[model samples]
Target chain A: MEPVSEVSGRAIPFGRKNIDTDIIIPAHWLKTISREGLGRGAFQALREDPANIFDQEEFKGAPILIAGDNFGCGSSREHAAWALLDMGIKAVIAPSFSDIFSGNAFKNGILTVVLPQEQVDRLLEVARTDPINIDLTTQTVTTPFQDRFAFEIDPFRKHCLLNGLDEVGLTLSRDEAIAGYETMQAAQMPWFAKGTGLAA
Target chain B: MASRPRTLYEKIWDAHVVEDRDDGTSILYIDRHLVHEVTSPQAFEALRLSGRKVRRPELTLAVPDHNLPTTPRLDSAGHRLPIADPESAQQLAALERNAPEFGIRYISATDAQQGIVHVVGPEQAFSLPGATIVCGDSHTACHGGIGALAFGIGTSEVEHVLATQTLLLKQSKTMEIVVDGDLTPGVTPKDLILHIIGVIGTAGGTGHVIEYRGKVFEEMSIEGRLTVCNMSIEGGARAGLIAPDEKTFAYLKGRPYAPKGSDWDEALAWWKTLHSDKGATFDKSVRINAADIQPTVTWGTSPEDVVPIGGVVPAPESFSDPSKQDAARASLDYMGLEPGQKLAEVEVQNIFIGSCTNSRIEDLRAAAAVLKGRKKANNVKWAIVVPGSGLVKRQAEEEGLDKIFIEAGLEWREPGCSACLGMNPDKVPAGERCVSTSNRNFVGRQGPGSRTHLVSPAMAAAAAVTGHLTDVRELME
Candidate 1:
């Protein structure tokens, strides 16, 4: 996973609500063994409409996606995140996100910014012409037109995203605590280890 | 000032918090993790790239479900493996190769023990009260029926749990939905939850953990409760759970992985405390009357887009929001329905009675009861009955449920998540309509341009026999 900090780029002003995984990356695209080259299949059904925003000339290579309330509302497929990443999107600005989708995006270094509906609407308007800038350290998303929006992210997540601390890194950092718990478990409930494949 | 009492959601969450980071997030430990072929390959690949071993391999279970065919390919010796589609073939093969390499147990496609991750978890007693279970597939919340705090996680989170045996989570708000009074005899748990989803819009439970409460849930059978909780994700809840009660303990007792002897007593004592403290409050609560719920079915793309089985298709113009109205209009176009069309009058060409939603043995029995001596309507060109698990298949066969299904012209097949997402060969032909027991009603979820009317297994069975959406309650026993 890549560490994310400050991002500056054009934003795709696709402010649609409750856009599910089926819309993001259709199930047919999930058959591939590799996560590579999913951008072609991203929004396959919607992109069929020649007028869709994702297929427009200006939105190509955009790094931020400005979406409406409750985006990413279904499925636990990480392929949705992979598809967005493949499409060159680095951040998603929305009013809210489905928990599973946001978790997936966070792990894959795609920053998800939650703002109020009004603020997201304002950003959606701002995204049409100028670039948007996001600074994780400052917790602010700024537009070229002097529009500024402040957001809140869990401090732990912000730190992890900033430092690229994946789960393995996070756990290895706390090896002492995990080892301590396992040793205690060995004493208190030896049978717990019996059925388990853990070293007895 | 005294502190407010904690809810079951809180109690379980608090007990599992290994370390609070003081930043609105905590490292929550997971006791059990289930995985399937569709989502784990990338996670396993990530572990390989990072040179990591699964921290607690024994705590994890893997199975091939989403990409496995439901038709058994028999060798001359009668040995069977479920494989037909080549892409799905690769998915199952990769999972088989990855499990042993990572020290995790892989229940193969041919293994009679193999099933959907959610079904196999509780069947083998791997999901216990107060346990925190995570899986790469959604509907992991089905385990919540057994009183475990279970829910779906993305493959990246799956890799996180694999490498660390814990997740860093910003806790969710809690919702308590209390449904009191007895359910009318024909009102199944599927109807009740579909009713609940109708009450709460598809996004209503967003950012909350729903704790199902009141007499209705307490009296519900574990299978019924599983059917309800399995679709919790449909209403946007990360997880939905009921407090473990006598029913839960009774279901888990004597199962393969359940506690034994004095351990059983000790575990029961602990599980008894899994419910909320008296007078504990939730962040949000919705009260519902059980008697008011009817046999429910979906008419639109969203799970919340449901009405009474006898109700008419909603007119998009009635919706105040133009976007939702447009969505409804698009859905009607896709479903081949006109505004105010009677739901039961719509013809259905196919019916699929399976999925994590309502593929358990109880679900089979409910549908079989309706299909026992009835012949499927000739208009219902083809129908299929897929059990939730390999074990469920055996038990259903023992009860002659397969014979009844076959006699009704419904194909009784091997166990896998067939046609739920069309990862396998069981797909509805384009432009055709199907009454499905799956949790989703997303456009093209069954196959491209396929119209899905989500209903209970009994309702699906009814549609199979009637060739249209019909109320299972109104069908003669």
Candidate 2:
């Protein structure tokens, strides 16, 4: 994961709502254990049209995606986030997002900005012509015409985005606390910890 | 001091919290972790790179289903056959190697216990009431039917759980969906959920964990409840739960991983108190009349495009929102549906009757009942019945359901996630429509250019026999 604080780029004006993970990267592209080269499969179905927005010269490789409500609404495959990152997308501005997708994006260091529908509509409109600017420190998305819209993000997630934090390492640091909980759990609910090992 | 009235979700969540942070995130312990081939290899690789051992390998289970072919894995001499697809073979091999390397228990593809992770979890009693389960697949909410707090996670989180046996999380708001009246005879739990998604739209439950309430769910069998909760992701909910009852206990008793003897008694006492307090309030509430539900089917690419079986394809203009109207037009175009076309008249080239959603023995029985004395119509080119797990397949065979399906000209295949996604060899061909019992109807979900109409197993069987999307009730007469 890379730290992300500020991003300025032309946004792909994909205003389609409910663009699920399948639309982002189909199930066929999920065969590899590696996360590289997925940008080629990002929106593979839509890219087949040749004239799709993603393939257009102006939007290709754009670092930001401005979408409609409920983006990434199906499937828990983090390949969707990896595909976006591989496509050089640094941030996504949407009216709302599926909880799992939003969390996945955050862990992958992709900034998800949630704004009102009107603000998103305005950004989508401005996105077609001019580049947009997103400042995490200020929590605002700005346009060339002085249009500024604020967004709310969880403080912990904001801290993580500002500094690439290894969540697993952080959690592991509290090993003692976890062990204590396990001890208590074992005493209180003995059946819950029955091992699933084959030998057992 | 009296504690605040809490819902079942709160009770379960509170029980699992290891520590609360000042920034509103909690380090929550995960009780059960289920892994599959597709989204897990990368996570395991990350753990290996970090030199991390699985904190509690005994708490995890691995199975390969997403990319495993439902075709026979053995030859005439009973020798194991290689997977025809190289990528799938490699992925399954990775899981086979990684599980043992990490000290986790694995049910190999050839093992009679191997099945779709969600199906395997409940049947083996690995997903118990008051437990917190996480998986790499979205249908993990199926475990929530047993009164567990289960939801899907990304591969990053998969690695996180494997290394620490915990997740950093924020609590989701609670929503209660209540349906009281008795469901009509022909209506199934699949229809009930599909109709609920239709009423609420896909994003209606976003950011909330839904608790299904009222008499209809109480009367539904555990398998039916699993079918309903399996599609919670499609409705934009991370999880959907139903409180555990005596029926839940009966379903779990004597299962392989269930607590035995005195331990069962102790677990039962706690599980009995897993319901919401009488005065508990929810962040959101939705009420529906059970009689209003029909044998529903989706007409477009999204799950929210559902309608009663007898309804006609809707015109794009019928949607009030401009964006939704555009989406409707796009869906109609991709699905090759006309504005006024009746749903029943829409022909399907293939039919699929399996997935985590509807591959249990009861689901097979429902489909078998519909196909008992019937045959697939000539227009239906491909029809396959894939069981959820090896045990389910064996149970169906013992009950003669396999004979009914084979006699109907439907192929009775092995247990795996066949035709649900296009990762495996089983996929609905391009430009063809399929009536599937799986959850998603997104474009290219079944395959590139494939059109999927989500339905129940019985509805899928009804379509297979008639070569079109016919209502199961019509066959009941």
| TM-score of each predicted structure versus truth | 0.96, 0.99
Number of clashes recorded per candidate: 0, 0
Model 2 Cα lDDT, one tens digit per residue, B1-477: 989999999999999999999999999999999999999999999998999999999899999999988889888998889998899999999999999999989999899998999999999998899999999999999998999999999999999999999999999999999999999988999999999999888999999999999999999999999998889888899999999999999999989999888989999999999999989999999999998889999999999899999999999999899999999999999999999999999999999999999999999999999999999999999999999999999999999999999999999998898899978999998899999999999999999999999999999999999999999999996
DockQ of predicted model 1: 0.52
Query: How much lDDT does each candidate structure score?
Result: 0.86, 0.93
Worst 10 residues of 1 chain B by lDDT: B73-82
Let me know the TM-score candidate 1 reaches against the reference structure.
Answer: 0.96
TM-score of chain B of 2: 0.99
Query: What is the per-residue lDDT of model 1 for residues B215-248, given as tens digits with 9 covering 90 to 100?
Result: 9999899999998889889889989999999999
The 10-residue segment with the lowest total lDDT in model 2 chain B: B414-423
Chain A superposition TM-score per model:
0.91, 0.97
* Candidate 1 residue runs with Cα over 4 Å from true position: A184-200, B1-4, B80-82
Q: lDDT by residue for model 2 over A44-146, one digit each (tens)?
A: 9998897899988999889999999999999999999999999999999999999999999999999999999999999889999999999999999999999
Model 2: residues >4 Å from true position, as ranges? A197-199
Docking class of predicted structure 1: medium
